[model samples]
Target: MKVALFGLGYVGCVSAGCFARAGHDVYGVDVNPVKVEILRSGKSPIVEKDVGELIAAAVEAGRLHATTSASEAVHATQVSLICVGTPSHPNGSLDLRYIYRVAEEIGAALRHRDAYHVVVIRSTVMPGTAAEVARILETQTGRKQGEGFGVVVNPEFLREGSAVSDFVEPPFTLLGGEHERALDVVAQLYADVDAPIVRAETRVAEMVKYANNVYHAAKITFANEVGNVCKALGIDSHKVMEIFCMDEKLNVSAAYLKPGFAFGGSCLPKDLRALTFRAKDLDIPVPMLESLIASNALQIRRVVDQLLRWKARKLGFLGLSFKGGTDDLRESPIVEVVETMIGKGYDVRIYDANVSLARLFGANKEYIEKEIPHIERLMCKTMDEVLEHADVIVIGNRSSEFAAALGRLRPEQRALDLVRLLDEPPESERYEGICW
Candidate 1:
């Protein structure tokens, strides 16, 4: 396969050399004459672990070349990979001028080609950018996408230091394309690479890089915060984290990562507060840890604002406890939201199978009495009674019973889901998610 990769930065230089090493003829394209000259002279433009030697080898073997001519590269290759830089704007948004410029050049080059070409975006971009690239190509080439040309988004997961090895052995290869022919072409390019090939939706594929980088950043911050707390307490943070990582079922795993309402439980809230308070008393400011409670409170406010926007006079809550299968209401975020709604003069009714006013005891019962004085009056006997009493239903907990309630809602009935009880949101417009 002949390939034209735009942008001779780290990603492009490494990718050009690696692909050429894999027996595919790769042509490097860029606006910088020095970078192009260096590539054309069998040398790498960027410094990495093994990219220099790899490019020298590929160039000496007559499998690689660099040029500033987009037309020449397009005429020689069947697929064009866009590896241009997407730097941040002044306002922190992605500056896509370079990407759009490369797209325009590729679109113009596609005007003279008679065969179908696959335009693959190998840069990190926001969602819907693949469609934007396809639209640009169609406008410039006077040809339709999926007919004369197509676009595929294939994000790169290569780290800077280990780019060469990462490319040779990636965690997985993801390809998102609307046309089967284009997807097949891109898939074949990575056939020699040892990784599972995943076919995902175009938008999801585009957002994968952001998710990976954000998670990596969050992990680093969390570890540093834990280390700070440990240092203040005269304990070894590394040893503590070593034990924490051993629990694969919860810590260092995908246990509590999901898009939904605020977290609330007897242990989590109490432990978090204890840690933050300890950090405060020690004269150490853990901003990330300190923001957790505030962030959780903001989520509760978001649900209340959504309900207020609907202007629904009567509201129903499917679950009242912090979580399902538990009668504990101590520090439950849903209880706070319910108290706010009732205080604002909205008629509220709640039904939790596990929570009973007559059976309340200990801290759980005492907590609700202080939060909402007349807790017994707000409680409902069954789900049907709550549904019939309110026009808007709020799914506040992940309960098995409320999973099918959205499907049974009437056309005029509205549902605000703080917890995603269903596998996915309902198709009706009346259904709304707290955060999606």
Candidate 2:
């Protein structure tokens, strides 16, 4: 395959070299004569890991060539990948002038060609960018899309320092295209890649790069905040987080990563408050850590608001403890929800198979007594008792016993799942998820 890689910058340089090395004749195009001259001399313009050597090898084998003319590059190649930069303006929005220019150039070059062409947007842009590029092509070429050419969004996930290795072995290949033929052409280009290729909607594919970058930024900020808090306490934050990351089941895993209700338990809320308080006493500011508690409190209030909107007076809780398989009630979030519902003059019944007055002892016992003093009145002997008495059933945890009672729920008796118990949403209209 003959490929024309526009913009001989970081992405374009690496992409052209890698593609050429993969047995494709690559024509590198750039507006800057210096960049073109450097690549034409069998050397990479950018100093990336292993890119210079790869370019030298590709050029030596006559598989890679550099050009200053888009018309020549486009006419010689079947596919053109736009790797131009999308810099930011003063207001922080994308400056797509360069990308638009490339689109016009490609569209102009397509006029001289008779074969169907595949144009891929490998640059990072917001949603609807693919459509905008398509409009530019149709306007320039005097030919309808899918008939003369097709556009696709194939986002690259390469880091700068390790770009060559990252390109050779990517996390995954994501292609977003409206035309089946175009998608197939892009997929076949990466047939040698070892990672999985995901075909998604054009908008979804375009937004994925932004999501990845933001999440990476958030992770760094979170780690730095934790380190600042730990420094004030004379504690080793690295060791603490290292241990914290070891528990893949809960922390640093997909266990609680989903969007759901507020988290409450004996440990999370209590330890977080204690840590933030310690940081406060030390006169160290950790706004991110401080905001966690406020955010959690808001989620609890949101649940109360949702319940009130439903107009359900009698509420039945499937689990009283913070989570399933636990009798501990210290700082449990649902306990706070129940207390709020009771204050609002709503009838509430709690049933936790693990939690019983006889089993409660120490701080756990005292905590429950202070929160819900008339605990004996609210406690139900069996799950059957709670299900029969309430108009709305709130699933507070992922308990196995809750699965058995799902089929027995009546249409009038609404079920609100605080935790996403089912992998997919249940097919019942009466069921609702706190957050989907």
Candidate 3:
């Protein structure tokens, strides 16, 4: 495969050199003449472990070259990887000037080229950036995507210091686009790389980088805050965290990673409230911990807002359980949302594959009867029945069936999703998620 990389910065340089070393013919393109000259002379413009040697070897073997001309690179390569920078603006939004400029250059280059080229975006962009880039390319080149040409968002997860190693052994490789041919071409390029490939829509691929980085940042802040709390309490923070991490069964891990309803269970809500209350009593302000409940409520409010904005009256809810694969309804945060909507006189129905009225005759039944009797009355016999009767649908659980239900929704019927159902949202008249 002949590859053209349209940036000679950190990600671009490493990726070009590494791919060249992997035996693919790689051409590095950049606006900077100095960077192009350095790469053309069998040297890397950016410093990284093993990158300089790798670039030297690939260049010496005649597998790698660099050019300032986008047209030359596009003409010589079957696939082009856009590795341009997307820095932040003053308001913290993405400044996509570089992305748009590089895309226009690529599109203009494609106008003269007859081959069906695959343009892979390896830039850290916002959700809609890939689609925007594709639109720009298509409009400029007078070519249709997935037909005259192809586009994909194959985000790079290479860390700066250990980028070479991360590239060779990535945790996962994500390819995003609707084009099957484009996916295949990109997949085959990294077929030798030892990592699981996750194919999704271009927007999802673009947003995954933001999600990963933000989560990492959140984890660091959370740990530091916990350490601060421990210091205030005269407790050993490291020892606490060490013990906390040991509970992989419940804590410091995937226990909270699943996307479902807003967290409201006896343990989470009650414990969070207790901890915050305790912190208040101690006169120790823990904003991070205190914000957890507020954040959770905000997510719930977002769902409510979506449904209300759509003016959905006959609303159907799939899964009453806090999460699917469980029958526990105690303190389910969605119960509050449902109850609130019911109080406002919206005809609501519910269908939980796991929860049946017959199964809930003990304490659970008594609790529901006393606390949320309206919900029990709204419960439907089947998912199909709920879909048949409702004007809107709310997917609040991570059930496997919810994915299939997305296709079954009518154009006018809105879906307010709390759990991310499809890897990409369906192209429908009405579909929304609280957070995507």
Candidate 4:
């Protein structure tokens, strides 16, 4: 396979070197003559581990070529990989001038060629960028996306320190495009590499890069805040984190990563509040820690606001507990929502299999009688009674039975699912999700 890689900067140089090393004929295109001359002399244009050797070997083996001309690079290759830089503006918006320029150059080159060319975006861009690139190609070449050219978002996940290994041994190869033929081209380019090729929506592929980087930044900031509090208390931050990471079932794994309603239970909200309060008392500002409560409040409010807009007078709750199969209603976020709706003069019917058991013969009976007598007054026995009495059904937790209740909903009744009640969400006019 022949590849035309634009931009000979950090990502460009590393990608060009690695792809060529993997036995592909790589033509690296750049506007800078210095980088081109450097690569032309059988040397890497950038300083990276194992990249210089790869470029040298590939060039010596007559597989790698570098030039300042896009025409030459495009004409020499079957597909183009845009590895251009998308810098930030002063207002923090993405500067896509370089990306658009490369798209134009590739489009102009494709006009003269008869072969269907696939354009792979290897830069870190925001969602909808690939669609815009495809539009640019269409305008320049006077052809539709699948006919003459196609765009596929193949976001790079290379950390600066270990870029060579990262390129060849990524966790997975994510290719996003509607056209299978274009997606297959990008996948085949990584066929020699050891990673699963994930074909997803173009917008999802583009946004995953931002999601990954922002999460990494958050993790680092969280550790720093934790370290600050630990140092002030004369505790070993490293040791605390080491022990924390050892809880593979909950802490260092995909436990609460899914997009759901506000988190509330016996432990998380209480522990997070106490930690943030203590950190504040120590004069160590942990904004990330303190912001969780405020963020959680907003998520709870978002559901209420959306419900109010629908003007649904009678609402049904599928699960009353913060989590399913637990009788504990202490600090459940949905309880607050229920209280708010009742205060707003809305008719509410609640049913939770676990809470019903707690109300009858469980330990939560005394607390339920003393604390939430109003919420307990509205409790129903079965899910069917709640579904029959309400205009909008709200699934507050993953109770498993709530999924079946969704199937039995009447045409007039709409369901607002806070927890994703289905493995694959239902596509219907009456069905809605808090976050999908």
Candidate 5:
């Protein structure tokens, strides 16, 4: 396969070299003549581990080349991967000039060619970028997308200094677009690569990189704040983290990462309160940790606010088990939300795949009956029954069936999402989120 890689910067150069090394004929394209000349001379323009050697090897083997003409690059390769930089502007919005310019160039190039081409965007962009790019291509080429040409968003996750290895062994590969044929073509290009391939819509693929990087940054800040607090208290933060990491059950793990009801389990809510209290006692501020509870409560408030704003007379909740797979409803924050809404005089219906009224005979049942006795009356036999009864739907868990049921929402009904359901919700009568 002949591949055209746009932007000969760090990501582009590494991608070009690695793809070429993988037996694909790769052409590096860029607006900068200096980078083009350097790559043409079998030298890499960027400093990265093993990238220069790979480029040198590929160039020597006649499997790679460099060019400044976007049209020439597009014409030479069957698949074109846009690896241009999407740097920030003054106001912190993405400077998509590079993306738009490259898309126009690719579109113009396609106008003169008769053969079907696959354009894959490897640049980091916001949710609507891929569709915008496809629209640009269609307007310029005077032909419809997924018909005359193929367009897809395939975001790259390579980190600096380790791009070559990351390319070869990525944690996962994401492909997004509407065209199944184009998806198959793009997937086959990576058939030799060892990574799980996730197929989604264009927006979801565009947002994946942002979500991943933001979470990574959040993790770093959280650890640093924890370390700072420990240092102020004269505790060994490293030893604490080491022991914390050992517990696959919860701390320093993926336990709390899932999108669900705001965390309100016995340990998390109580421990956070205790930690923040300790921080206050020591006069050491932990804003990030402190913000955790505030942020979580904000999510709950948003759910309540949306329901109120929708004027929903009756609310139907599809899951009550804190999560779908668990039976523990002990400190489930959602129970509080439901109880509060019921207290506000809104009728509520609930269903959980794993929760049974008979199973809740002991403390759990007493807790629910006392705090949210309305739940016992509102509980339904099945999900379909819940869906049938309410004016509004609230998905509080990551149940696979709930995710699937999003498409079944009525035109006049509203969905308040705590967990992101569909990548891009269709424009319906009503749909809202705690966060996008």
Candidate 6:
């Protein structure tokens, strides 16, 4: 496959070299003549580890070319990758003039030829950016998008020093687009790569890079903040973090990573508050650490606000504890929601089998006896009781029974799911996920 790249910067130089090394004919386009001449002369325009050798070898093998003309590059290649820079403005918005210009150039190049071309947005961009590029293409070429050209947001995950290795062995290959034929063609180009091919909608693909980068930044800041505190307390933060990262079940793995309701439990909320309290007493500032409580409270407020708009007096709760199958109501988020609902004059009925059983002699009994004695009035005998008397059903946990109860809601009744009850949304029209 002949591939054309729109920028001869870091990404374009690395992409052209790697793709050509993988047996694809590559052409790089740039507005700057110096970068174009450097690549054309079989020398890399940018300095990076192992990239120059790959570019040199590909150029010597007659598989790589560079030009200053987008038309020249697009005419000789089957697919065009937008590798241009999206710089930040003073106000922090993306300056996407380069992206729009490259799209227009590709669109104009496609005007003369009737063959369908694939435009890949390999640059990091915001959601709906690919659609804007598609619109620009359609307006410029005077041909509908999906008819003459297809837009795919194929974001790259390469780092600065290890770009070659990252491109050769990415975590996974994401191919997000709407057109089937174009997606297949792009997938075939990566046939020799050893990575799982994840197909998603264009917006999701565009948002993945941002999510990953922000998470990475947060991780680094968290580690540094912990290290600072450890240094102040004469403890080895490295050893602490090394052991912390070894907990693959929860700490370093995919536990608590999904978008859902506010986190509240006996351990998390209590431990977080304790840590922040100690940090503040030590005269140390941990804004990120301190923000957890405020953020959690805000999430609870958001849930209350969503429920307030429902205009239903009778509210049913599937689970009341912080987690499913637990009778410990200590710091449970659903318990807060229920208390708030009761304060707002909504008739609350809760059915948690574990909590009901625990009321006999466990934490539930103690919590009801001391914390909120009124909760005893809200408790119901069975799930059927709540199902029988409520206008809106709220699923607060992932209890196995809650998934099937979604199928039993009446036509006028609705469900608000905090934890995703199923892998996919239920087939009911009245169901709403807090965050999908």
Whose TM-score is greatest here? 4
Which pairs of residues collide in model 2? none
lDDT of each: 0.89, 0.88, 0.86, 0.93, 0.85, 0.90
How do the predictions measure up, each by TM-score?
A: 0.96, 0.78, 0.80, 0.98, 0.82, 0.97
Who wins the lDDT comparison? Answer: 4
Runs with alpha carbons beyond 4 Å of true place in candidate 5: 249-254, 314-332, 338-361, 364-436
Q: Which run of 10 residues does model 5 get worst, by summed lDDT?
A: 354-363
By lDDT rank, best first, the candidates go: 4, 6, 1, 2, 3, 5
Write the residue-wise lDDT of candidate 4 on 165-211 in tens digits. Answer: 99999999999999998998889899899999999999999989999
In terms of lDDT, model 5 sits at: 0.85
Question: What's the residue-level lDDT of 151 in candidate 5?
Answer: 88
Question: How high a TM-score does candidate 2 get?
Answer: 0.78
Tens digits of per-residue lDDT, candidate 3, 1-436, equal 9999999999998998789878899989999999999998988899999999999999999999899999899999999999988888999988999889988988999898888899998989888888888899999899788766898999899999999999999989999999999999999899889889999988878888988999988888888877877777798999998898899787766777866458876688898888778767777787988898898988788778777888878989997878777777888877878888998899999998677753555447667777777788889888999998889889878888887888888867778788887777776568877765
Which residue pairs collide in model 5, if any? none
TM-score of predicted structure 4: 0.98
* Candidates 1 and 2 compared by TM-score, better number: 1
What local lDDT score does residue 65 receive in model 5, on the 0 to 100 scale?
A: 93
Q: What stretches of model 4 exceed 4 Å from their correct place?
A: none
- Give per-residue lDDT, candidate 1, residue 259: 84
Number of the candidate with higher TM-score, 2 or 3: 3
Find the 10 residues in a row with the least total lDDT in model 2: 357-366
